[model samples]
Target: MNQLKVELIVDNRVNRSTLSGNGIRNAVSLQPVLYVGGIPNNNHINLTGSGLNAYGFQGCLSSFIVDGRLLDYQRALVLN
Candidate 1:
Protein backbone atom coordinates (compact mmCIF):
# COMPACT_ATOMS: atom_id res chain seq x y z
CA MET A 1 0.00 0.00 0.00
CA ASN A 2 1.06 3.56 -0.68
CA GLN A 3 1.63 5.53 2.52
CA LEU A 4 1.36 9.25 2.72
CA LYS A 5 3.15 11.50 5.19
CA VAL A 6 0.84 13.93 6.95
CA GLU A 7 1.72 16.98 9.02
CA LEU A 8 -0.31 19.33 11.21
CA ILE A 9 -0.08 22.24 13.68
CA VAL A 10 -2.66 23.00 16.33
CA ASP A 11 -3.23 24.89 19.53
CA ASN A 12 -1.64 23.20 22.50
CA ARG A 13 -4.33 24.01 25.03
CA VAL A 14 -7.30 23.00 22.89
CA ASN A 15 -8.71 20.15 24.89
CA ARG A 16 -8.06 16.98 22.89
CA SER A 17 -11.29 15.44 24.04
CA THR A 18 -11.57 13.23 21.00
CA LEU A 19 -8.24 11.67 21.61
CA SER A 20 -7.47 10.97 25.23
CA GLY A 21 -6.01 8.20 27.34
CA ASN A 22 -5.34 5.08 25.26
CA GLY A 23 -6.70 6.78 22.17
CA ILE A 24 -3.70 9.09 22.31
CA ARG A 25 -1.43 6.30 21.16
CA ASN A 26 -1.24 5.20 17.54
CA ALA A 27 -3.90 7.59 16.44
CA VAL A 28 -4.02 10.79 14.45
CA SER A 29 -6.20 12.55 16.96
CA LEU A 30 -8.16 15.36 15.35
CA GLN A 31 -10.57 17.57 17.17
CA PRO A 32 -13.88 16.10 15.97
CA VAL A 33 -12.61 12.89 14.47
CA LEU A 34 -9.79 10.49 13.86
CA TYR A 35 -9.02 9.47 10.26
CA VAL A 36 -7.56 6.14 9.36
CA GLY A 37 -7.23 5.11 5.74
CA GLY A 38 -5.19 3.25 3.15
CA ILE A 39 -4.10 -0.22 4.21
CA PRO A 40 -5.66 0.27 7.62
CA ASN A 41 -2.87 -1.38 9.51
CA ASN A 42 -0.99 0.11 12.42
CA ASN A 43 1.26 2.31 10.36
CA HIS A 44 3.30 5.18 11.70
CA ILE A 45 2.20 8.69 10.76
CA ASN A 46 4.46 11.61 11.58
CA LEU A 47 3.13 15.15 12.16
CA THR A 48 5.54 18.08 12.52
CA GLY A 49 5.26 21.82 12.12
CA SER A 50 5.07 25.09 13.97
CA GLY A 51 2.62 25.83 16.77
CA LEU A 52 -0.55 27.93 16.72
CA ASN A 53 -1.86 30.60 19.06
CA ALA A 54 -5.39 30.97 20.36
CA TYR A 55 -6.47 33.19 23.18
CA GLY A 56 -3.51 32.68 25.54
CA PHE A 57 -2.58 29.15 24.67
CA GLN A 58 -0.12 27.66 22.20
CA GLY A 59 -1.23 24.78 20.00
CA CYS A 60 0.97 22.11 18.48
CA LEU A 61 -0.08 19.10 16.43
CA SER A 62 1.03 16.72 13.72
CA SER A 63 -0.59 13.57 12.28
CA PHE A 64 -2.12 11.74 9.34
CA ILE A 65 -5.70 11.74 8.11
CA VAL A 66 -7.22 10.65 4.83
CA ASP A 67 -6.33 12.75 1.77
CA GLY A 68 -9.34 15.06 1.65
CA ARG A 69 -9.67 15.32 5.41
CA LEU A 70 -6.88 17.90 5.38
CA LEU A 71 -9.45 20.51 4.38
CA ASP A 72 -11.10 20.37 7.75
CA TYR A 73 -7.85 19.89 9.59
CA GLN A 74 -6.34 22.93 7.95
CA ARG A 75 -9.35 24.97 8.92
CA ALA A 76 -8.96 23.99 12.53
CA LEU A 77 -5.22 24.43 12.29
CA VAL A 78 -5.45 28.00 11.02
CA LEU A 79 -8.67 29.45 12.36
CA ASN A 80 -8.42 28.33 15.93
Candidate 2:
Protein backbone atom coordinates (compact mmCIF):
# COMPACT_ATOMS: atom_id res chain seq x y z
CA MET A 1 0.00 0.00 0.00
CA ASN A 2 1.29 3.39 -0.91
CA GLN A 3 1.01 6.11 1.67
CA LEU A 4 1.32 9.87 1.63
CA LYS A 5 1.67 12.56 4.29
CA VAL A 6 0.36 16.12 4.23
CA GLU A 7 1.34 19.05 6.42
CA LEU A 8 -0.31 22.47 6.67
CA ILE A 9 1.46 25.40 8.29
CA VAL A 10 -0.60 28.46 9.15
CA ASP A 11 -0.93 31.39 11.50
CA ASN A 12 -3.02 30.22 14.42
CA ARG A 13 -4.44 33.65 15.20
CA VAL A 14 -5.43 34.45 11.64
CA ASN A 15 -6.83 31.01 10.99
CA ARG A 16 -8.89 31.07 14.13
CA SER A 17 -10.38 34.46 13.26
CA THR A 18 -11.30 33.25 9.81
CA LEU A 19 -12.98 30.16 11.18
CA SER A 20 -15.00 32.14 13.66
CA GLY A 21 -16.06 34.59 11.00
CA ASN A 22 -19.38 34.03 9.26
CA GLY A 23 -17.81 33.79 5.85
CA ILE A 24 -15.63 30.81 4.94
CA ARG A 25 -16.93 28.95 7.92
CA ASN A 26 -17.54 25.50 6.51
CA ALA A 27 -14.33 25.06 4.66
CA VAL A 28 -11.06 23.52 5.72
CA SER A 29 -8.45 26.25 5.68
CA LEU A 30 -5.81 23.71 4.89
CA GLN A 31 -5.86 20.54 2.77
CA PRO A 32 -9.55 20.55 2.07
CA VAL A 33 -9.69 17.44 -0.09
CA LEU A 34 -7.75 15.12 -2.29
CA TYR A 35 -8.81 14.12 -5.80
CA VAL A 36 -7.53 10.87 -7.15
CA GLY A 37 -8.87 9.06 -10.15
CA GLY A 38 -8.90 5.31 -10.61
CA ILE A 39 -8.75 2.71 -7.89
CA PRO A 40 -5.75 1.09 -6.33
CA ASN A 41 -5.63 -2.38 -4.92
CA ASN A 42 -3.64 -1.19 -1.91
CA ASN A 43 -3.58 2.44 -1.00
CA HIS A 44 -3.30 4.21 2.31
CA ILE A 45 -3.96 7.84 3.23
CA ASN A 46 -2.51 9.27 6.42
CA LEU A 47 -3.14 12.64 8.01
CA THR A 48 -0.28 13.42 10.30
CA GLY A 49 1.27 16.56 11.77
CA SER A 50 -1.15 18.82 9.97
CA GLY A 51 -2.57 22.22 10.76
CA LEU A 52 0.67 23.29 12.39
CA ASN A 53 0.70 26.87 13.68
CA ALA A 54 3.74 28.68 12.38
CA TYR A 55 3.83 30.84 15.50
CA GLY A 56 2.28 29.57 18.68
CA PHE A 57 -0.80 31.46 19.75
CA GLN A 58 0.30 34.22 22.15
CA GLY A 59 -2.73 34.18 24.39
CA CYS A 60 -5.87 32.24 24.98
CA LEU A 61 -7.32 33.09 21.56
CA SER A 62 -6.96 30.96 18.45
CA SER A 63 -8.43 27.72 17.24
CA PHE A 64 -9.26 25.63 14.18
CA ILE A 65 -11.05 22.57 12.92
CA VAL A 66 -9.66 19.62 11.05
CA ASP A 67 -11.96 17.16 9.34
CA GLY A 68 -14.85 18.49 11.29
CA ARG A 69 -12.82 18.24 14.50
CA LEU A 70 -12.32 21.32 16.63
CA LEU A 71 -9.05 21.93 18.47
CA ASP A 72 -8.67 24.80 20.93
CA TYR A 73 -5.39 25.46 22.66
CA GLN A 74 -3.51 28.57 23.74
CA ARG A 75 -0.30 29.09 25.66
CA ALA A 76 2.86 31.09 25.87
CA LEU A 77 5.68 30.31 23.44
CA VAL A 78 9.24 29.69 24.64
CA LEU A 79 11.95 30.01 22.04
CA ASN A 80 15.47 28.70 22.40
Error of 1 at 1 (Å): 1.2
Candidate 1 residue-wise lDDT, 1-80, digit = tens:
22324443344343323223333344443545443333224644433221221123234336433455534566755865
Off by over 4 Å in 1: 12-80
Compose the digit string of candidate 2's lDDT tens values, residues 1-80.
Answer: 22223333455322232122222222223444322232233633322333222233333324444566655333212320
User: Which ten-residue region of model 2 has the weakest summed lDDT?
Assistant: 17-26
Candidate 2 regions with alpha-carbon error over 4 angstroms: 12-61, 74-80
Residue-level error in angstroms, candidate 1, position 71: 12
Q: After best superposition, candidate 1 residue 22: deviation in angstroms?
A: 28
Q: Highest TM-score, which number? A: 2
Q: What are the models' TM-scores?
A: 0.16, 0.20
